[model samples]
Target: MSSGGYKPVVNTVRHSITTVSKRKRSSISEPSNNHEPVVVHRPHTSLAPPGSSRKPSKSSRRRRRVRKERSSSSVDRQWVFSASNFRNLKDKLVLVSYNLLGVDNASNHMDLYYNILPQHLDWSRRKHLICKEISRYNATILCLQEVDRFDDLDSLLKNRGFQGVHKRRTGEASDGCSIFWKEKLFKLLHHEEIEFDRFGMRNNVAQLCVLEMNCEDPESKLCMQSSEQTCTSPRRLVVGNIHVLFNPKRGDIKLGQVRLLLEKAYKLSQEWGNIPVAIAGDLNSTPNSAIYDFVASADLDTRLHDRRQISGQSELDTKRSPFRNQHAVSASQTNEWSQEELQLATGGQATTHVRHQLMLNSAYAGVPGTLRTRDQCGEPLATTCHSRFQGTVDYIWHTKELVPVRVLETLPTDVLRRTGGLPSEKWGSDHLAIACELAFMGEGC
Candidate 1:
């Protein structure tokens, strides 16, 4: 493919990586798809021209904006806030979730990205871009999927004062889930690696970690934890990272993997005095799909869904729960096999109803965003864009203990279309990174 959609920008100065930055920037425009374009109103700045000494007047700035708008429209991929609580909030943290398309996988799946330019898919070049894109966020915590190049990422992020743990997927999949955190802010208290293959959920895996805040009280300024013997640790949070299976046909396996991860996360939370929990990754399930509904609502009746179309990735199945699994099985020729699949998905409890106690909320859904970039539920219209499919499958979900202050919005579909697909010169992967600033909720509020 040609590099016709490539968009380049001036590189910014590198800053110390110890502290996460909350700065925002305007994103370049893309080729138009069938979706409507979002026009953002950029805030007027007093920044003087290159070598000019004096700041331009209001009228001149207005003229400049008019010319820029006429030349091209752009989307603001910045952190959006509903309120100013974050300004006064203490112990605030920024979390980012991304799926860095693995090098080996990318090469093996060239047919899936035939429309992408050869240079854009080059691992050597893409790796640098990936690091730079991630560095821009300076997130306090990162939940990454398809990270086969953990050593490279570790070296790059280590300079930023981040410590990470990697759990490679079982079987032949080279990519795995990795969780990285700012060492200055959080200390690793406990961690667990889960391989779903053991539970008949295939070779997918998940990573869980209990991160303890390195400070004393929430009211006091953050201080390094004392080395002396301390009976109790400070406030903490449970971080769960997973890349759910991508096979849309195996909804039963998908649900089983998610269920196991959540179960593990809940157990870890209880062991740590019920700390807040945040789960992030590429779930491979669209918003409002049966799997998504199960995660958000914490209950799902397996009998109401079809095992083959549980993730809602199939266009033929629009209803979250179209029909009873038994009826669908009986209607089809694979009655006995489908029956066992239902039991496997439901944990063989002879019950269709499944529930969880996490009470989690999606960060993007909790925060309001522009109509251009967000859906009715406030989720990015498309997190992953490629030649075959372009839709949302990545998310950052958290418990009630953490409240979303601001979220890093994704590019609009129109903007993405300009690139003809993903893994463009501007983006290192097919999926856009999603991030959010979360604050610990106060006792009363």
Candidate 2:
């Protein structure tokens, strides 16, 4: 027989099966005569109770009704606080970003150095400090860059009672970005890691998270002391976390990478349909750099412009505000200050500095009252002389669909000590984590 003719005959025999149960017996029988096998169909009705109606019972009807109601209720609840519901998120969501300097394994004295480490000091310890700082602000979403491995971060958040979704490493610097959320509040739908060659270095872009906020009803009224109900604003928002390359040697390279990152984010936004996005991260370059322009020009519309409001310097008059020359300061000056110096001098407040060049080129400059800082913990050391000249290197940008209710930098003392400390054998990473909280106006993002 030809191959095709024999193939179908073999398949017909292979599909035959026979089973005998209390209620029924099923089988495929073949005739002794050299003819094709036949498939017989039979269904026993003995399983039915005596006099039972073939139609469903009243209780089954009730169950079906309840199941439908439950399914609809779940969808309504989800839609009630979708990304579109929240037009402004000043106090609803918080986003954080930090660089975890890769782990150093060169030390030979593993016993003394590694053993004394706190149980939490492992990846979990560092992630705990970060999550703890984030929890302080009640952050809903967090973005971390330069993660050594996905496992290290998973272990950290797992230990802290938090869950995270991360992308696989692509190239050199197996370094990647990840996002963690309060699982009780948000659900992750999709995640992917993107890599592109820029200049000569290989850079990575991680796009992860589809968040849903457990928001309060904006139209719902709160009962007043007099028994009358007053309307309250909506709560809940959606956000995106990103980490762009910072290496200045390859401006063109970084610019291209930024373009690719924005492309991916824009595609996600379209796929999500009407969902607002907040992109946060340690963009290696400040807002003034071309890379920032590339991101700002993407489908994302900047809801808040750059602002310089000094913290801890409340005692200092407006004339002494370190943020005064925020626009005038050069990239060189911003780089000269250490994270510790910026934290101490700002009185635990951090600044967001954009490129003066972009301000000069665009009409979006001079958005007043937009710039602000939050308090950092711990007292300044007397030996450290004066606080560092601080400016905004980190950032929080939002879409027009979402409004900014409150955006501030978070710098807890313990986090500062861990991130600002010089590269040491004990610490898991460098760079203080910056966090922000935003409130929604109508529906949750």
**lDDT by candidate, in order shown:** 0.74, 0.40
What is the Cα-based lDDT of residue 148 in candidate 1?
94
Per-residue lDDT over 220-268 for candidate 1, one digit per residue giving the tens place of the 0 to 100 score: 3433234573625366899999999988778888888888888889999
Task: Record all residue pairs in model 1 with backbone atoms less than 3 Å apart, i.e. clashing.
Answer: 30-418, 31-418
What is the TM-score (0 to 1) of candidate 1? 0.76
Weakest ten-residue segment in model 1 by summed lDDT: 1-10
Candidate 2 per-residue lDDT, tens place, 1-445, comes to: 0011111111111111222232333454654475444545578555578988576578855544333322222210000112123333333554555555434321322332331223323554555555455555555567776666668667656665457866534655556677787655555666666655322325556564556543333422211112253324223233455565544433334444544554556566667664556666655554443344544443221112211211111122335632221324233422233343333222223542212101111101111111111211111111000122232345555655444333332222222232222222222343545543444434322
Off by over 4 Å in 1: 1-76, 83-86, 216-233, 315-339, 443-445
Best by TM-score: 1
lDDT of 2: 0.40
Q: At residue 157, give the lDDT of candidate 1.
A: 86
**Clash count per candidate:** 2, 29
Cα shift from native, residue 432, model 2 (Å): 1.8
